[model samples]
Target: MAEVAIRGVHKSYNKVPTVHGVDLSIADGEFVVLLGPSGCGKSTLLRMIAGLEEITAGEIAIDGTVVNALEPRERGCAMVFQNYALYPHMTVAENIGYALKVAGTRKPERRARVAAVAQSLGIAELLDRKPGTLSGGQRQRVAIGRAMIREPKVFLFDEPLSNLDAKLRAQMRIEIRRLHQRLGVTSVFVTHDQVEAMTLADRLVVLNHGRIEQIGTPTEVYRRPASRFVAGFIGAPAMNFLTGTLAADGRIAIGSGAGTPVTIGVRPDEIQLLDAPLKGTLDFEIELVEELGTGQVFYGRSGEMEMTVMRNGGGEAALPRSGQRLFLKIPMTCVHLFEVESGRRIDLPPSRLAAE
Candidate 1:
């Protein structure tokens, strides 16, 4: 296992910057995921670490050795791409053992190692099957097996499960995490899927446009987002955003018409439905309701700002339908206020502002 360090790394294409100067340190044997939307430079950063892409500036070190000059093969990193790059002509066992074969290992030792890895991944039975004959998950297993055979100091996954169905992806996620636990390899994974990032990462490095937004454990990033972009990007259905001025410490009046110009965010699950109008309650004009298996997502507007609430349950309980009105008590602690200009979080004490 190796600790990977990226210090003030920058990458640009045709004089247009993609990865702005970024710094990060991934611990030995820790799983770090680079998460962002398309064009966020996550893949670029991963490639740079693997020596597939050159660093335009700054230092990249693996196990304390500066590797900006090393070739991909010399970096001692094994990479699993989004597309399972298995050779169609080779059987699963052959593909998984290819790296060892290239390095000139004896046939008997190679075969033994292949068998051990295949058994670990639960794909020992499929060893003789070619890539074309295997299921997507199986092919993915072969690809992962190939990477494992090398036993490199670092493992890099670039959205390796992106091609699988949702169910298969979830299953493979568990497999990958298990592999990490068993092997204890330092790993860096890049993906736009927040669920994948959340489930697999020991720590998440959230990127926005090429810049690092926040780096923390999944719960830390979720519970306390550093910026509006992070607050909206990290959650499913995204965080509900409203434009209003802080009328008081815990109160916000939605609309540019009367309040201060500030932006506040709320997690969909944090919104609480009210049985009756309370002192801090606000009216929500319901526009839609979706019955998710775990709960319901309510889409509505308060004044001109749209709001979404993820209520716990599989049915219509505690939710008003379209064109109806519902009262909600958005807890003060759950309400996150951001500065209008920079979109940074603003923390306020309960006694700081006048009560509504």
Candidate 2:
């Protein structure tokens, strides 16, 4: 296990900058996920860490050693790629022990090491099988085992589960987490999937347009996103942003009106759909409804703004139909405020004003 320090890292391709000055310190054994949308430079940053891409500027250190000048092999980092880059002709044992064989470790010792790693990955029985014969999850386990056999100081995963089915991805997540617990290896994962980022990361580094937007634990980032981009990107259905004005009484006056122009942000799940009329309730016209087995997601429009509402485990009678008009209450405590012009989050006490 080793700590990773990234200081003023920058990258560019043919004079076009892709990764700006990014500084992050990853503690030993911590699982850090770099999250963002496409073209956000997350993959570029990960590649730089693995020494697969050269840094245009700045320093990277592993276990207190500057590794900017070192090759990937010399940096003591093992990277697992998304494609499960295994040799089709080689058996699982050979693939897992390839590094050892290249280093000239005796076959007896290499086989022993491969056996142990495969056992840990719960694929000991498949040691003799080729990757083509294995299931996606099994192949992924082999890929992981190959990395594990290296016993590197840090583990780098570049969207390793993107190719798997949802169920297999979930299972691999558990396996990877369990492996990290057992080995205590410092790991860095890169992905655009917010769910994968939220569930796998000890802390998330939200990146956008080559810059670091926010760095925090999943809970902190979800509860208190540092910027409007983060608030919208981290949640499913995204955060609902309504153009509005902040009232003198600390309440938000949604829609065009006279007051301080601002933006109100709230998650879909945070909005309460009131069956009966209440003070300060806004009218929402449902346009579509998606059944999610245990819950429902309603997509609709309120006045001129479009929004989504999520309800968990509501009975059939409670489900609202498309074209239905409902009342929505935005709890002040769950409200997020942002500057309309800058898109930056603003701190405000919970509004005391209720539905007027």
Candidate 3:
């Protein structure tokens, strides 16, 4: 395993910068994920670390050695691409051992290594099958096995599960997590999927446009987002944002189109259907309710903004019909305040925002 250090890294095409100056340190054996929307430079950054993209400025070092000038193979890293880049005609065994063969390992040793990796990946029985004969998941495993056989110090996965079905993606995520735990290799994964980033990463580096938005453990980013962008991007059904003004008592006064003040931004799960706290209750018109097995998501329009509420299994039964008026209770603690102009979080004292 090796630590990767990126110092003031920058990249561009024809003088138009795509990756702004960025610095990040990845610890040895740490599973770090680069997460962002498309065109955010996450993949470009990964490719730069893999030595596939040339660095326009600054340095990339692996295990304390400067590798900006090194080739991809010499950087001691293996990259698994979005597309399963397997040789069509090559059998699984041949594909897995191809890199070893290229490095001139003896045929016997290569076969042994291939078999060991295949067994570890539970693909031993499929060794002789060609790529065309394998399922999507199996082909992906062969792609991963090929990388494993190289025994590189760093593993780079660029949206490796993007092509798989939902069920397969979930299963492969567990398998990948287990494999990483067993191998303990330094890994840099790039993905646009927030759930994958949340579940798989030891730490997530959130990127925006060509710069870093926030970097933290998944829990930290989820619970205490550094920016409104991070807050909205990291959550499912996303965090609700409503424009409001901070009042004298540190309370946020939401404004109606006609200038009436209302409270804003209590997460759906945090909003309870209750009778008390009349001041925090808002009338909502239920537009739809989705049943998701263990829970139901209530989609409604509160004033002018659309709001989503996640209820743990009982919401559907109690939810009102479309266009019906219902009171949604907002607990003060779950409300996140953001500056209307700057789109930055408002740091309110706990005492002021705390629930009574």
Candidate 4:
């Protein structure tokens, strides 16, 4: 296991920068995920660390040794690509032990390492099969096993699960996490899937347009986002944003053209159908109801403001219907206020906004 450090790194093509100056330190045995939308430079940054891309400026060091000038193989890192880059004609055993063979390890030792890695990845029985004879998930395992046989200090995953089916992807995700825990090798996984980053990473590095947006543990970024971009990007059904202003008395007023004053952001889960605070309730026209097993998501127009509400399995006897008016109660504590112009969060003191 080795720690990887990137200092003021920059990369470009024909003088047009793709990766801005990025400084990141990935601890030994830590699974740090680079997460962002496509064209956001996450993959470019990963390639740079793998020594696949030349840095326009700055330094990269692995295990305390500067390796900006080193080749990918010399850097002692193994990369698993988005496409399962397995040899079509080579059997699983041959593919996994090819690197060892090239490095001139004897047949016995090479076979032992291949079998060990295959067993760890649960693909030992498939050793004699060729890539074409295996399923996508099996092929991916072979790809990973090939990398494991190299015994590199750092493991780089470039959206390795992107090509698998949804069910297979979920299964592979758990397997990958378990494998990492068992091997305890330092890993950098790049993916655009927010759920993948949230569930797999020890820490997530959120990127936007070739620059770092925020870096934190999954819980920290999800709970206390640094900016509106992050707040909206990290959550599912994404956090709804309504333009509003801070009143002189610290109240938030939102709406457009004869709009009502809505001082708070009510997370879907926080809003409830209740009788109390009758005056505070917003009248909503239910447009859709999606039943998601344990809960249901209500989507509708609350006056001119769009809103979503999450309700547990059992609630008030009456279920909302299309075009029906319903009162939605929003607790003050669940509200998040932000400065309208700058889009930064407002640190509202507790004394002013009393909670239920």
lDDT of predicted model 3 = 0.86
For candidate 3, write residues 178-291 as lDDT tens digits.
999999999999999999999999999999988998889999888877677888898877777766666667665565343323334555677776433377677777789777
The digit string of per-residue lDDT tens for model 1 on 1-356 reads: 89999999999998899999999999999999999999999999999999989899999999999999999888999999898989989999999999999889999999999999999889999999889998889888889989998999999999999999999999999989998998999999999999999999999999999999999999999988888999999999899887778764356665565546788788989888865788867788889988887888889887767888888874445456789888887775677788899999887775653354
> How well does candidate 3 score on lDDT at residue 348?
73
What is candidate 1's CA lDDT for residue 305?
73
lDDT of each model, Cα atoms only? 0.89, 0.91, 0.86, 0.84
Local distance difference test, candidate 1: 0.89
RMSD in Å for all candidates: 2.2, 1.7, 2.6, 2.9
Task: Arrange candidates, best lDDT first.
Answer: 2, 1, 3, 4
Give candidate 1's error at residue 152 in angstroms.
1.0
Reference-based lDDT, residue 8, model 2: 99
TM-score of 2: 0.96
C-alpha lDDT (0 to 100) for residue 124 of candidate 4:
94
Reference-based TM-score of each model: 0.94, 0.96, 0.94, 0.91
Model 4: lDDT of residue 276: 37
For model 1, what is the alpha-carbon lDDT of residue 99?
A: 90
